[model samples]
Target: MTKAFASQGDLTEKKITFDEVGRDLWAFTAEGDPNSGVIIGDDSVMIVEAQATPRLAAKVIEKVREVTDKPISHVVLTHYHAVRVLGASAYGASQIVMSEAARAMVAERGQEDWDSEFQRFPRLFEGHESIPGLTWPTTTFNDRMTVYLGRRRVDIMRLGRAHTAGDAVIYVPDANVMFTGDIVEDHSACYCGDGHFHDWPGTLDRIRAFDLDAIAPGRGGALIGSDRVNGAIEATRDFVRSTYRPAARVALRGGTLREAWEAVRAECDPKFGDYAIYEHCLPFNVARAYDEALDIDTPRIWTAERDLAMWAALQG
Candidate 1:
């Protein structure tokens, strides 16, 4: 029998964990569900990634309230994925920030991504009706920008492309922690449907260069310490490389997409089958890898119609 399309069958709720990775930085993770970060600055707080919807974000808010009452001053989006940005409204922050490329993605394929993701992973969009609309960045920077929460400096930088073209990583200088949006995941699968596989390792290298003390990764538990941080970064690199190599080999040999799919499964499943969302991400990862290997510089847009068609073809 065919597997359920994407994560549609994943209806069970995951237990949430709010742990401090840095002095005042907290990671909100839910048993491999999409994770968000809380950076409590001198006078206010900065949320790293907004959950899929306001309802999901409210859970993050509740965790934040338990510790401090400082107002949320900024909501920084690491990229333009619907599951990452659609919940911006719930923050009530003065500024919503993104990289220049991320904002362009919002204008270009934001709605399509929203529709496609809602269909692919219904569990993440549990309170879909509460979404105000497509989340837009009120503030945007090209490469790097710094914000001061009353002397606590948070550096938001577009290190390099990995998870998405516009991926951003927020660094807390005082605490030596970084909120690496899907560019680094702790025991969670990297969703590579819109990734740049060739450049992903370079991006990982840039992140590794920091020798960060801690990291609040995209979709797993908080990573604290140099050893654990480096381990997660390398593990993500391994997952990306493992998924791309086999698919690239198939694509270069002029194999069909289905052939690439099987090749990727054979290579990745043994190592990553038990990872969170590994199966949900495998097909898209292979498709993107195949295209990239064929020298497709940019990823093709993923829509709901195209999603179903791709799934059907792979199944056949």
Candidate 2:
């Protein structure tokens, strides 16, 4: 209310890049905005991480058309975040997939997250009116499921919790490439508003163990080589560690939230100050980190009102 979430002021349109990360694997990235992955198989295509609205999803559709005429047979939601899953209808895919945990979160706090994210980043919800409603997965999996687009094998698994309790990763064995949701970011701030900070690093390790050749990360550019891919993974790990360590120290000492906030800032700013959405994500990240450090396992649902109240507290 005082100023606005930093992302609210980010109205500048980013340049979209539809890059080929692997053989028929494409990454639709728009600067540091949320990204989507396109996997073209023998008979059809699978989309990973739908955009915020039908209008935005149309942009990814346009890119998919440029390369393949195959029908979009599946839409895989890496998590239940509003920014990533609200554009489902646009795909018209026969199957929409999400982890059981992700679907449960949708039933529990999906609408609240939608309202909260829409308030935080107005630019992303440009075609909010076009969204039919909250996106729901027609198909759900417990821990792992293998969906094949013709002969192409895509393994969808919940590696560990980072961005949210329902976070999942889509691994394409042939390409040795993985589409990680917010579990890992490249030169972009990890939005921990609903994250599990302690479990995040181990998840990154699980991803790294695959020795991926490339990664279509949740945000930032598509990583195409071992060096760049591994760099992003380590950097993401460092960002989480840097953020939580200071906040955890403050919380362990029984300091106030504001004190934890200050402690986190002093540690993280030097490293991630210039990262995409850095300012927009910092308060929420610090708050969640402090709570998790204090042994709060599940992240509290973030609503529109909570967004404003948290911002006011940090700013004051």
Candidate 3:
């Protein structure tokens, strides 16, 4: 049997932090785990990112309780990813919100994605049995929408697609902070399994235009200063450019997937070797990049069976 570590392992839950950026804006981040954000309004609260499961989400809720007693009336999904939106039920939210494109992506491949991700990282789905079903958005906007948290304003915008076809950023203009769901990662590897390599840089440019002083990325710690925020965006962009572009070039040149993976490892490892999820992300990243380089608009589904088959083909 695979042994679990004493202090930590994939399944180990990390401590949650209630990072206060301003009076009412806060970030609930697990130690380098998937992070969530809390926005407290005059009379209500909104949760950004629902987490992987209800059990995992409760940890975030616990942090939220430490700051406010307002009922969580809105759950915003920056994008449709199993790890980010599956825990909506735990929030007991009045209305769950997502971009129109995100909702469409959920409808298109939500089930396949849930299966693929669970297969890739079984440890993250500790209490898989508790998941009620696919999370559906109660409300979805086409491009941009704004919400008022008492007198404070929160803007949810589907700026452009990068990490996913429907990537969104939650902007707290008052605090000059933004919650970039997978669009901006701080010291964490970009999971390009379902990403757009070519358009991702442009998306990062859109995020950089925010003039954000602070940012809570989809993974890693909260960036606290404007310089750090810019660093996060640049780092994330560099990962995409350095890792996937060469992989795409190799694939387009008729190089094998194994060859492409090797190219990426050699090129990226010297830089991002220690970043979280780099090893696990590379194979899928190469596969998706290969497809996109060939003009595949949508990423192909990754079933467990397909994952192994691809791994075996690349590994051999």
Candidate 4:
């Protein structure tokens, strides 16, 4: 029998873990579900990656309240995925920040992405009605922006493109911690449907250049200590390279998309098959890698129609 579309069959609720990764930084993870990072600055809080909906974000807020009462003053969208940004309203943050490229993506494909993701993963969109609308970034920057919550410094920088053309990381220089959005998933599959395969490794190198004591990745457990941080980075690099390289080679050799898909699965499944969302992400990841191998510089927008059609073709 055919597998359920994307994560539709994953209905069981995951156990949530709110652990302090650094002095004041917390990682809110849920058994490999989408994770969020909390930076409790001296004066206020900065939330990285809003949950899927306001109801979901409220759970994150409850965890934040357990630690401190400082208001969530800012919400940062590291990229423009619907699961990451649709919950922005719940935070009541004064400023919603994102990279300029991310802002453009919201304007261009936000609605389509919202529709696509809602269909793909119904469980994550539990409170779909609570979403005010497409989350908009009130503030945007091209390269980097610095915010000071009292004496602590939080740097939001768009190092390069990895998960998306606009991916950014929240760096805490003083604490030696980084909230790497989807750029570096610890044990989870990197959703590369909207990624830049060729540019991703370079982006990972840029992330490695930082002296990180801890990393709250987009998924999986928090990496605490420099050794764990480096390990996660290397694992992510290996995952990206292993998935893209073989698939790209197949496409460059005049192979069909199915051939490239099969090649990628043959190469990646043995190593990363058991990882979170590995099966759900494989088809899209291979599709993007195949296109990129043939020199498609930009990723095509994914709509609900496109999602179903692609899944049908690949899974057939």
Candidate 5:
């Protein structure tokens, strides 16, 4: 072990911000850390993207309590990631909602992902022992599902794959606000450990078609205006494109994995080096980009052993 694993050295606590993006829509952002969106309706609330654990989620719970006493009736997982879905139990939402693809991923590799992410990001999993087990969704939808929070409509749609096979977004038509989980990041590195790089740009195009006034991205501060929303989308698209294009080109030319990694670092580091988790995400991002460029459609499951191996290969 030459260098620390993903985000292991990132132990400094980030400042969390709970910004009201709409009348009842809130974004709980922690600098460049994972974010959670809160939608308060007439009588109840819906949480999007749970934190890493119950103890970590309690911070968000405290924020939720400050604004409203509404019971969290629904919890929506934008994708099947340990850091995003494991804290779902803390909300105690009766119906945990996600896409059918996400449910399958959870069933297939949820435990492995949990262990893998815990090792990669120990700071985020402050209370790893508190996690009862793998979080499972109570309800699953194919393409889209609309849930009413007392007349407020929150449309959850799987608008193609970017971050994962089952990446979904929560769109509020009335509020013109969209909650994109890792699909559109701002001033942060997009973790492409399990991403679909080839299809990600098209997904971003689909998201751009929406008439959104504000956006609550998975990381970074909430985008407040339409311009900022568009900027975030473009930034995310650029990051994905800049990262994958060079690696894919290297792979297409039958270059080695290290060559692909070097290509990406040479092209992207100048622009994205200062972003959070840039170093942590580089190897995995390059690996996926290399695979996708070689026509591998689905992302392979990431295990703890694989994480170490990949890190050692790239970093050592």
Candidate 6:
């Protein structure tokens, strides 16, 4: 089944849509690829999530130019994943904002993560040579920080942990739109490689508390209506729960990693087999869930070599 999906070749790169949510807020998304949020302030612009490389982010920058030539003053990182960040320097934002926890994560494992992810998805980081180094945050904050886009208020909050330890959601108060970085995916697949299985659901609830009218998830289409927004959130929560629960149940029984992996494959494959990166993500997802079910809090680092060994052990 995994081979079948790979045979379909990579998902074609789609044109990014600059969907207007409110006066100056726009959601820039290209299929299930990394998304960026554009907030036009009175004097400048704030961009959320820098694609993957400077070359990749250049396209997003092009879109931002269409609206305003205001210098990109701030680049807000929702988390410190290689795909989500790394491209930040391209924006040349005066200040790069991130959660202190995220900055710490980068300090601890940024290099390993960069190597691991580059090996996993070569196509996403096509211009890998163009990357100078791991992106470092110039400014770090704890809990929540609010920035005004002139009169518009954009609240960057570390609303619990879902995708990674230092995850944030951008809330546009006047527009009632939230840019949830991998916390909520629409019809696209969910990447649970380094996730907190036990706490992800509760974190989703925390995100829902914002009562957003529209949301731009980490990937996939922009959720337009309230029902669609709620639907996307529920779908993401369900995907995480469904993927983790069965694996945890197997682990509690003292099952081996292979057994836990098989359990998840059997349960999720039938439903999510066709989703992008299902084959790539399942091994890491099961491994992390198995560790968490046995009381391992911090997930072990995944190197390129380790990724291959785990995949062979689980699915070879």
Summing lDDT over every window of 10 consecutive residues in candidate 1, give the lowest-scoring window.
Answer: 307-316
TM, every model:
0.99, 0.98, 0.94, 0.99, 0.98, 0.95
Once fitted onto the true fold, the runs of candidate 1 whose alpha carbons sit more than 4 angstroms away are none
lDDT of the structure predicted as candidate 3: 0.83
User: Clash totals for all models, in order?
Assistant: 0, 0, 1, 0, 0, 0
User: Which lDDT tens digits does candidate 3 get at residues 157-180?
Assistant: 987878898988999887888888
Stretches of candidate 6 exceeding 4 Å from the true structure? 1-11
**Pairs of residues clashing in candidate 2:** none
The residue pairs found clashing in candidate 1 are none
lDDT per residue for candidate 1 within 244-315, as digits (tens), equals: 999999999989999999988888889888999887888888889999999998899999999988887885
Expressed as tens digits, the lDDT of each residue in 70-92 for candidate 4 is 99999998999999999989999
Better of 2 and 6 by TM-score: 2
Q: lDDT by residue for model 6 over 157-201, one digit each (tens)?
A: 987888888988888888888889998987777888778877899
Q: Which pairs clash in model 5? A: none
- Across 1-316, the per-residue lDDT of candidate 5 in tens digits comes to 4777788988899999999999989999998999999999999999999899999999999999999999999999999999998989999899999999999999999999998999999999998899988888999999999999999999999999999999999999999899999999999999997999878999999998996889999999999988999998998999999999999899999999999998999999899999988899999999999999998888888999999999989976
- Cα lDDT for residue 312, model 4? 88
Worst 10 residues of 6 by lDDT: 1-10
Query: What lDDT score belongs to each candidate, Candidate 1 first?
Result: 0.92, 0.93, 0.83, 0.93, 0.93, 0.84
293 Cα displacement, candidate 1 (Å)? 0.5
